[model samples]
Target chain A: MSGQLTLYTYWRSSAAYRVRIGLALKGLEYASEPVHLVQDGGQQHAAAFAALNPQELVPVLRHGDQVLRQSLAILEYIDETWPKPALLPADAGGRARVRALAQAIACDVHPLNNLRVLQYLERELDVAAPAREAWVRHWIGSGLDAVEKLLAGDPGTGAFCHGDAPGLADCVLVPQLYNARRFGLDLAGWPVIARIDAACAALPAFAAAVPEAQPDGPRS
Target chain B: MSGQLTLYTYWRSSAAYRVRIGLALKGLEYASEPVHLVQDGGQQHAAAFAALNPQELVPVLRHGDQVLRQSLAILEYIDETWPKPALLPADAGGRARVRALAQAIACDVHPLNNLRVLQYLERELDVAAPAREAWVRHWIGSGLDAVEKLLAGDPGTGAFCHGDAPGLADCVLVPQLYNARRFGLDLAGWPVIARIDAACAALPAFAAAVPEAQPDGPRS
Candidate 1:
């Protein structure tokens, strides 16, 4: 945890945003190497970035010599390496619940509405822009609805997705909500998720990791 | 590990297949509650299953009173609950590597080509059969290609994805390879993955988890 760390990040990428929140929460400092997924046919597709992650994806963490891809895996690695302010709950069952919430977004939701997938729908499938936007909103709505049920229905829920603390699930939820808002989805229906998102945004760790705060963030 | 365990699984679900492999690896027994994803507008959509998992997805693990959703989370829970014959490595870096390899399939590849996504392509977008097949193969090919490099390039990979014994990555790999073959993609191109798949297939733990071996397997 003491060595030099570098993060390959994109300002608006939800997966990258999850990692950013994780690093900040752990109080770990790392140099940022921005990989634009859009500019010039995606800098992630460049030979140099591809060498780092053959998947040609962002949010690649370089911890010393070991390069780790996959946002959830990287989050776990961080949690294991630096156990303080643990990202996951101590018990196995609690950990499973938290992870299920995270995957509810990362696997079940975000993958469907990813930029690359959207691009494929547009380029290969010839989906119109409105249709593509609808696709994004549809998945986000259903995904967040499931998440809201998980969060609201469980007695374990406190101020966050798991316990009172903002943990792994919160890390994923904040970013997904951010993306949802960008698509003009009204989140008033998901009162629990909205509450958690608001709470997370108040914290410096989550606040600093917002898409607009990154070095490569969009200029307003 | 010695209590009533129920798995709501679809016969050919890769995600459920991954969990079945994990359960078998840990030598735990469970009752199979087949939730046919296709029959009668998908049993996963029924009210009972929805109460278990709002995501409306297969591979819901019911251990006593606790209902666990998401395959990767279930795998880790099983590993944590039963330490012997551990699925993840002891070391932090090794665990990260194994998790990354697993996510390379679970997240990067499988979600894209899942039945829900494919059905969306066909029903919602009116994507033709051949184009849909191309989409599936494209993801599987690209995904497995990344896995092959990660395994073959690293010394950490032994007979299995991580070590001499089959672990988490192998659990994910075997099922994905099975799905890929069902799609008629040649495994010959990924010699490393092919070799590991063969090794995993030889194990009774992995062999018992094959889609065809399940009680709910295809009638033919």
Candidate 2:
């Protein structure tokens, strides 16, 4: 936990945003190295970055010599290494529930709408902007609808996705909602998710991790 | 671990196959409730299954009162609930590497090529069969390309993805290779993955969990 931490990130990438929230929640300081997913036809495709992660994806965490890819994995590594303000719950069942919620967004929703996938839809598939918009809405809407039901139906849900704390699921959920609103989707359809988003936004960790606050964000 | 275990699964679902492999590795028994993802407009849409998992996704593991959704979460839950013959490595770095490899397939590849996405591409956007095939192959090929690099580049990769034992990454990787082959894509492009796939296929745990062996499978 004490080793030098550095994150290869993009300002608007939700995966990077997830890791930022995680680092903040654990009170871990890390240097930021932005890898623009858009400019210059994607910096992630550069030889240097590709050497760091053959996947050529951002949110790569370099904690000492262990270079990590995948936002969920990096978050888990941070939790296991630090073990304070746990990103996951203590019980196995609770941890499973938290992870399932996280995957609901990370796996089902965000992957469909991320920059690379959108680029493929546009550049290769020749999917028009309107249809592409529909594609994004379709996945996000259905994904959030399920997440709402998951949160609303379960009594375990409190102010956040699991319990009152903003943990792994919250770290993931807030970013997806950010993308949803960016696409001009209404949050009214997912009241539970909207409420959780509100709760998470109030937290300093979540607040500081917003896309707009990053070094390479538009406002900066 | 001793509690009654039930899995709501689809025969051809790579996600369900992952949990099946994990259960097999742990030497745990579970009752399979096959929910055919294709037949009858997908039985996963049924209210009975929806009540269990609003996500309407396969590989929902029910352990006593706790019903879990998401394949990776279920696999992790299985590992935590039963420590013997562990799926993840003992060290934090090793565990992160294994999980990252697993997510490279689960989150990056499978989500894009799953039945629902393919159906959406066809029904919503009216993407032609050839183009849809390209979409599938694009994600799968690139995903496996990354996996192959991760495996071949790392000295840690052995007979399996992480070590000599067939663990979590192996369970996820083999099913993905199966899907790639089903799409008529050649495995020769990814030698490391192909080698690992053959190694995994040699195990009874993996062999018994193949799509063809399931009760709902075609040969059944």
Candidate 3:
């Protein structure tokens, strides 16, 4: 809202998708500078993009002079900078719970199955396609199962991951579930998450942030 | 600190060690309930422990009746609940930078090299020792190399990761560097990080929170 906001993102990157949802949810407009992850040995690794984010990862949000990386961190920054329609819960305990739920997927599940890791498994470790697929599903399934348990029993759960409003956890969760489906994992196993996803999908913010809706997406 | 604070942690868990440093930094007293990750087929998976954290992860901090999982989230929780020595910076941009730096290791490098993931790489994929070791080094080296870039180029980085104070990023970085050494990854390559680690190591708080100093650690 304050500066020339630009996001270096990829269509299929779950991390990037998470940030996209955060921006959409905040009703913030930004320029998308798509960095193709798979084309030509990863455009993310290119000197220019790498200069922006030395991690050579996507979802690098540039707000004027400020360069931000890591999806969850960016989400938090967005929430903090534009305090209207807060992404996290009001109470400290609730914020902790939402952050935990988001990290359950972001740190634990998403990192293990990202593009570079999968590439390493294939090219470096010589893991076959089916095995790689299984590896992806294995982590996603277990991680989601844990998340389901976290949601199922907690009295705090409502229409979304926190209360009725979709916040940080929902932003992180929707993209992860999208990635899970992309890798051929079923959502039927986690009814709570499935319902949450349905709720998130009903929102135009979440709808506009999907991979297929991105400028660089295949369908686009 | 009100109510009983009990941490269900594993000795060698990098995640748990992070929370320990956070608690120590805050001068908060807590009971350490060590859950052996390797022994007894990982006590984390035990029914009772699993009930506490359905994620079956360590560093599950129970403050009163509130159970918190995920190290970074727990660290933020500690910061918010007891805002004595802030783990994050006061300014939004600074907080974003610190969180991004912390997450660069937590979400990107650490998860790829953690116990369960390594086990999957070996037991499931049959990746041999040398290859697994290489895999660990690859992630750590690249991650730290990027971290080095993150620290070196930024004027914001001081004696510690952010402005001479050992805050959130330092807590995450030190344990990661420790794990890097455990896997035979040298820290000499990242001078900025190595120097910061040295600075952090000199603190009694960080020293007391080390894995070797824990009740379940080897020395203890």
> What TM-score does structure 2 among the candidates reach?
0.99
| Candidate 1 local lDDT, B1-220, one digit each (tens) | 5558999998799999999999999999899999999998999999989999999998999888888999999999999988889999899999999998998888889999988889888888899999999889988998888888888889999999998988999989899999999999999999999899888888999889988888999766
Give the candidates in order of lDDT, highest first. 3, 2, 1
State the TM-score of the second chain for every model: 0.98, 0.98, 0.98
CAPRI band of model 3? high
Which window of ten consecutive residues has the lowest lDDT sum in model 2 chain B? B1-10
Off by over 4 Å in 3: none
Candidate 1 per-residue lDDT over residues A1-220, each given as its tens digit: 5678999999999999999999999999999999999999999999988888888888899999889989999999999999989999998889999999999899888988888889888998899999899888888998999999998889889999998999999999999999999999988999999988899989999988989999999877
Per-residue accuracy of model 2 over B1-220 as CA lDDT, tens digit each: 4679999888899999999999998888889999988888899999999999999999899999899999999999999999889999999999999999999999999999999999999998889999999999999999998999999999889988998998999989989999999999999988888889999998899988999999888973
Point out the higher-scoring one by lDDT: 1 or 2.
2
Error of 3 at B151 (Å): 0.2
Docking class of 2: high
Score candidate 1 by DockQ.
0.83
RMSD of each: 1.1, 1.0, 1.0
- Write out the backbone clash pairs for model 1: none
Q: In model 3, what is the error at residue B5, expressed in angstroms?
A: 1.0
